[model samples]
Target: MSDTPQIHGRVEPGFEALREVFTTNFTDRGDIGASLAIYVDGRPVMDLWGGQADPGTGRPWTEDTVALVYSATKGVTATLVNRLVEQGTLDLLAPVADYWPDFGKAGKEHVTVTQLLSHQAGLPVPAEPLTRQELIDGTPVLDVLCRQSPLWEPGTAHGYHALTFGWLVGELVRRATGSTLGALVREQIADPLGLSLWIGLPQDRNSSVAPLINGRPDPAALDSITDPEVKQLALQVVAAVSDPDSLLSRTLSTNGALPTPEASTWNDERIWAAEQPAANGITNARALARMYAACVGEVDGVRLLSEDAVSTARAEQVQGPDEVTIGESRFGIGYQLPTHAAPLLGEGSFGHAGAGGALGFGNVTSRVGFGYVQNQLGASLIGEPRTAALIDALGGVLA
Candidate 1:
């Protein structure tokens, strides 16, 4: 009923400044609707949300409002796979083709699970265009992916697999667990922890999600990259993204009719209901933060992973210029390592950022888990300044 954005939720005594950062996001940073949550030493220290859930309908953002956290979903998916590794069912160093022989075709025989998880498999996009229906079903897309050739030799270079990461990781999960990534996540992580996150969202829960509003990057968005070689690559990627016939466009816009990279695919119900581990998972800051918290330590008597598993998953597998984004990338298995895009966490923090500003991460050494979700999208390589500010504010408390 109120026209003005109202901040709602609790912040423990030590984390008071986080509340100020959340409020400033609405008042000064143009945040339309967002939530920020943090867990430290196995308990929640902050849980907050404000602004409108749907700007078009003027629906207020609430404690229950969830949103599609594009690539941040990777952190969850990675946890699913890493669990298999911990159980010794899947070996990180083993060839991916060993588990799924079909994946070995077309010069991909030696691609290891580590290479796939670390984004060094050089399969950033599919060899051919696919439809949303294929993405929803996933089997047909997996068939195509198995038979496709790597755009580059495995391990020689690394690039963000983007859309392909879900299929690659999902198929590996199915081979190891006899269950889909979504099903495993629910049974092993979400259900035990009682977290409100979904890899494959149920149709009935659709209305609970906030609608995503797309944003455009300014023409000079890439001007901040100072490295000359990386800058040149960034310009090339930007140009390819704009050209519909380029690999970047064809890969991003599986449906040729839709605009590449900027398509409103996540806004579609079909996307939300499907399991795309690299791109589509519906959740809020609380679920994300709590899930990450469980990864590193006990949260309410539940710990999703052992300390050794967490160490292996967060250990930096690769760091260098990414062939796709033409930006410096750091990856540890399926999680994005601390880099310029998400450098606010401590030295060893690891998590994933969505295409927009959404981010979810946990610092192992610091015993901190943080999650931020926003519907108003921004095209920042690392994360939105608003989310970064919250991370900065968090540091003062942790210090």
Candidate 2:
């Protein structure tokens, strides 16, 4: 068990010290499977993954293996939004209602692209308990959201869009590009660039996708919060999760699978098959890093996001209180900021972390794209063990 895996890659000789850091967290564990890849100044530097793809079957994880990144998919979604802006097809400051007319409901006629991308638009959980079928079905859920009221004045405050964030933003892309975000991503970003990332995971590729495992060993005790009003809302959230029919529960249930309280969401073959871009991006470290590298540099002469687009992508937008998702997340236009909310490659770096420890992001500061994906979900608000350790290792290399 002490013998760490010999996963392939070419890490610089001096940087080989990171192999121990990588092994430390990925140490032999039947329930865990992951992969990590780093590209610095537009070149592949480190790539590794270990543990089992599925403990019951004894399948070993490999370079090509992909895992559901949960929220980490947000950074990628943000990238696509920036790409559209680059082509002048979409405007960041323009009102969202320009593309989707019904989105102007509840005094939200002025909500702009920046507001939605930065999660300041005030739509976290839907006002209605949307069914899981309603969500994976796509059109129905979006219809509810379009006609729903804003939780607050759009630009006055900021909130995180927990589950519906992707669709809220993805729909804008659909209206602007005449293609679903997943379709545009595959045709314009993933396929042309040869990156293994997928927004709408294909059924044929299901075999290589890793399964998620709850590893919080310790979880938050809501009982300690003590405030009557706050406790009430928390309890409601708890009840919604325990109630399998609740929208939050059903939206994540996915093809007969039950939703767990700690895990943000699950990707059954169906969830993956749908184009839920803001979350449910199932790809491995190799794939995530390779795709992000395109944003950081040219890959075979193809750039997914222009240098200006990358700059715009990394620009910080919401930094104080994130009304919708976690209490406070430092967010850029569409990507998670390198602030305390989501720690990553380092300050000035931008990326996203999924529920639990699954994380992925790229660094415009160092011209690097780094990604780490794991099936073992961590309990932390931002991410898990791999995040801190991976960033530390990357910091050493960048230093």
Candidate 3:
């Protein structure tokens, strides 16, 4: 593919420099393909791509090539939860049991939607044996979650929910609206706003998506943790992640009809599909940046959320060593807000870094929404080289 921009959009002062980050590493490090976009104040400024849509066939990455965002889709899902709050159907502060009564069992009656959103409901790293098949069908997995006991006391400490974040939040949406989270997202968030994102994709659109290649694993992360149980859990997460056929793998693989992991398949026909709102958002850089830009700009003639709401989304909701993330991580109600006290994620920015290397976040201070997705997944929790370059260039752009 030519170095010409992959998607059309207005370019901001620092955007071309940001593109260089991808171009340099993308070419030097060797990339199958990548697309990037940047939006500021509701207008797209930069969009570009290089490499192959199908490296296997030497198919060029085109103007519309979209890649699987691994876990970057979580940002989109969190946006829906905010919209639910905006529409008044779901209260972020309400108890989980309020929507699904059975969820109240096992000392979890007090866990609020806000708490769950912040990964403080204490059920991270589920204790029960959950099969990929059961999780593929959300209802069964939820049945187990409802009965499962908390690992830590509710609100006592927070741990990253990893895969369970979607189930916990998605289940609440299902009970509150009587529709799957995917359906509600289509109806309320994407369609209305004209965003190309999807929580669960349909089966027909599979061919357009680029296959995900999880990045090289860091040997240090493997060697550091000595706990047998924690290591086992991490191992399970890693193994499930490598195969597109795993339950969560489906969203990244073929069988694109549903966003659940079990739908993933390694075959060619299974390669592309819709953006799974939780972790399988299939989007181009242009769309990714613009989506967040809308949050900072006028969103379909409406602001994504009022300044107050955005403030709430970005403010520190849970602090201290995260129970799940269990490091310097900080979380806002439904977003990741790193504190000045701990800035591993990003400072004054809000969003999530997808598993592997995909990342999307909005800088409230700069009113910037940036997204970086790559076929080469990185092990860094927040981002890899592509994203780091983008951020550095963005800083220079601002400077």
Candidate 4:
């Protein structure tokens, strides 16, 4: 691969530094194919994409190329739920059983929508192992979640619900709106904002999706890091997540649903067609940024969430050492609050990072929305270095 990959897209005059950072990601940071986009005050400031869509086929990453954004889908899912809250269709404080009575089983009778969204409901993983077919079918997965008991007392602690969060929340949306989460994403959020995002991608659009080149961290890379503190932190994270019996591992894998650490199963079309609200969201950087931009301010006269709603969504709901990721973690209603794991534009910024490197977030203080998607998957449980570099450059530009 050439050190200088041909980069595409425009940057607003003042945001030229972002383009440089984007280019550096390919040349220096091991980015295979990726797109980065930013919007400030409801206007596009930077839109860039480059590298190969399929390195094997020699297909160049185009403006329309979309990639699966793993758990970054959580941010999008959070937006949908919050929108329902804003419209008075779903109440945050109401028991989830009010919508789906079966969710009330197994000591979950009192699990509120707020607690579930905030990752405080303690339904991190189902007790039994689930097959990929079962997950794609959706019904078997929902049945398992409804019957499983919480790992801890709901609202007493928090853990990342890597896979189950989708079914738990989607069931509520389904019962309340008589529509699937994917349909709501299109009718309520994507279509209104003119975004190319989808929780359940269509068959015709499948060809436009970029296949992921999944990977994990190299021990040699960690050993070579010059910063002692950074190296130690990286090593610790790798150890915790790699341990099969650890909460991080079980929660991420859904107790053997995704047995592989690399999770190459995501590359399958069947998974892409299914609705996994907490994961498997297919989109480009432009759509992701625009979606978040609308959250904080108007975009083309469309505002997804009002100022008061944004405030409520971003207000800290939980904080402390995370039981799943084993680090300091924080959350708002359904959005991830800024922490060492996900340093999303500092205070008043909320978003979620995926299992790989995908990220999307909106900052209320700066009226900024940022999105990044890539086919190259990174292993870092916390923030990936490539994203950290781009965010630092963006922060410099804002300063």
Candidate 5:
């Protein structure tokens, strides 16, 4: 790699710092291939990308390269739900059982749609693991979730729902609107905004998506932790995640259904064809940013949410120690707030970060929409240095 990575895209004059930060990511921070885009006041201010999309094949990341952004899909999913709410087809505070009666059983009778979207329904992991086929089929996953008891009382606590969130939201949407989440997204959001984003990726677009490169840290690296207690806890968390039967592992694996949740499973086109709204979304950073930009303001005559909807979605729905994440976290309607997992943008920014470093968010305070996607995975829950640097640069530019 050169001293300065050859970044391809334009940055508004005063925003030159963004290019410097983006270049440093490849030269200094091991960013393989990624793209970062930002929109301000409903206009594009920056659009940039660089590096090899596939290291093995030496495929260059291009202006149109799309990456599978794991959890960042949640931000888009939440946006879809919020759209329904705006249309009065779905109510955030309405009991979920009002739409899907099956969800009311097993102590979830009182759970509201907002609680499910905010990760407060305690359905992070189901009682039984669902097979990949079941996940693809969709109905089985919904049946299992409806019958299982929540780990805690609904609305009392918050935890990252992970895999279960998709089915919960998708089922509600299907019951309420009689359309799949993917169809709704294309019809309402993507078509209006002219974005290339997809929940259930179309067959023709598969060739443009860069394969994910999983990032796993060496276990020996843990020995460097100075605090004994912190080291032990970290190891314990790692152990739970590695164990096939553990809640974290099972939920991620869909009960040992996926061959490997992190990398291989997603490479399979079948996964892409299915609509796992919580994950498996594919899009370029520009589309992600534009989607978020439309959330808070107009983008090309399209506004996804009203000001009232934006305010409602960004309001703090749950905050405190998360049962699943095992740390202090915060969430709005369906988006992660500026919490430990993704403390980027600004005070009132809300978005979702993927398993690796992919993130998308809109800041109502600054009226800034930001999106980032990378094939090179990172090991931080908050974000790797590359994303942190770009966000810091953005903050400086805004300041």
Candidate 6:
């Protein structure tokens, strides 16, 4: 309400440096509205949120304000899939056709659940581009995926599935569990843990959602960079994404199925109401951190997965030059592993970074679970600068 953003929430005694980093994000890093939470050994140590939830209306971000975390939703989806595996409802090594008979078609009879979750299934974009209406209805996209052929040999390489990963994995979960991904998320993950997380947000909670402010990179920013190597890398990324025929472009856009990443399409209530498990997860930092905390250890007598199950989910499934990103990437069953692309708290840290800057990760070695959500999307697809700074400060505290 004042000239300065009103910061809120608490931090444990040793974690004060995190608060300093969070404050500088508003003053220096251009963060409009954001929240960050951390859990150590399954208990919260830091919970912070601030800035304007709706700059247009002068509404400040509150503890309950949730933002749409793009690909960070993939980490949550992976958790559900692994939980099914832990319960024997789904098999990681079994062929996907075992659950969905239609998916075995188009030379994909041998693709396994592990391959799909790890992004090595070679089905990045559909053969036919889908319409926005088709994406909202959901069935048409699944049908298209069923008839689509792998762009590369299955399990030979990995690419970011972007949007299609949701439909591919969501349909598999539906056929195996007899419930939608969003329903399972609510029934199993959200309700039991009492978290304010959702894949398909309910209409009643729509008012609390923060609208994303696009932060697509500007070419002029390249001129301001002092380092030549960083500038060159940035230039190459710009070239790859600018080409409509490039793998990075086609994969991210799903061959034009998705609206431009900078567009306001994600802010629509209709999109929020639809189930897109790979994206469109509306949640705050507290729930994201707590969920990861439950995964690795226990939070309030609740553990999402056994140690063995967490190990299996975090185990490396693929690592190499990703065909889609045009850079090195790493993945486990469904989580992004530590790499230059997303150097999440060093080794034993596994989580996913969203399209914008939202990130969530769990570090097994340190017994830390971290989550950061923001209304203003950052330019970098991975290794978002604001989260990077917070993580750096966290490293200092941990050391």
Candidate 3, lDDT over the whole model: 0.65
TM-score, prediction 5: 0.94
lDDT of 6 by residue, 55-147 (tens): 989888998999999999999999888899999999999999999999999989999999999999888777787788788788998898899
**Model 2 ranges with Cα > 4 A deviation:** 1-8, 28-31, 219-267, 381-383
Model 6, runs deviating above 4 Å? 1-4, 216-232
Task: Write the residue-wise lDDT of candidate 5 on 1-399 in tens digits.
Answer: 445657999899899999888888888776889999999999999999998888788789999899899889999999999889989999988999999998999899999999999999989876876667888888888888999999999888888888889888988999999999989999998888888789999999988889988775644557666677556656666777768777667667777786333777778798888898998888879988999999989998899999999989989998887787665679999998896545787677989988778889999988899999998878643336677888989999998
Worst 10 residues of 1 by lDDT: 254-263
Residue-wise lDDT of candidate 1 within 1-399, one digit each (tens)? 123478999999988999987888777666789999999988999999999999899898999999988888999998888888988989999999888988999989999999999989878776666766776788888888887888899999998887889988988888877898999999988999888899989999999999888775656767787877657766776677778777566656653633323437568888888888888889999999999999989999998889989999988888987777666889997898887655857667988888777889988988888999988887654347778898889988888
lDDT of candidate 1 at residue 265, scale 0 to 100: 59
Per-residue lDDT for 82 in model 3?
Answer: 81
Model 2 agreement with the true structure over 260-280: per-residue lDDT tens digits: 324435646878888887777
| Runs off by more than 4 Å, candidate 4 | 224-236, 259-263
Whole-model lDDT, model 6: 0.87
| Range of the 10 consecutive residues with the lowest summed lDDT in candidate 5 | 377-386
Candidate 3's residue-wise lDDT over 1-399, tens digit each? 334323323456646776666677665444557777766666666766767676677767776666677567777777778877877888877898999898999889999988898878876544455554555556665777788888788888877676677777888888899887778767765676666566665676566666766455566775576776556655765675566555334323322333322323312332333222456567666666766776666744756666777777777777766544334567786677755332422575787776556677777677777776666555532225556666677777776
Task: Give the TM-score (vs. native) of candidate 6.
Answer: 0.96
The window of 10 residues in a row where model 3 has the poorest summed lDDT is: 259-268
Q: What TM-score would every model get versus the actual structure? A: 0.92, 0.86, 0.81, 0.96, 0.94, 0.96
lDDT scores of the candidates, listed in order: 0.83, 0.73, 0.65, 0.87, 0.85, 0.87
Better of 3 and 5 by TM-score: 5
- Tens digit of per-residue lDDT, candidate 4, span 63-93: 9999999889999999999999999999999
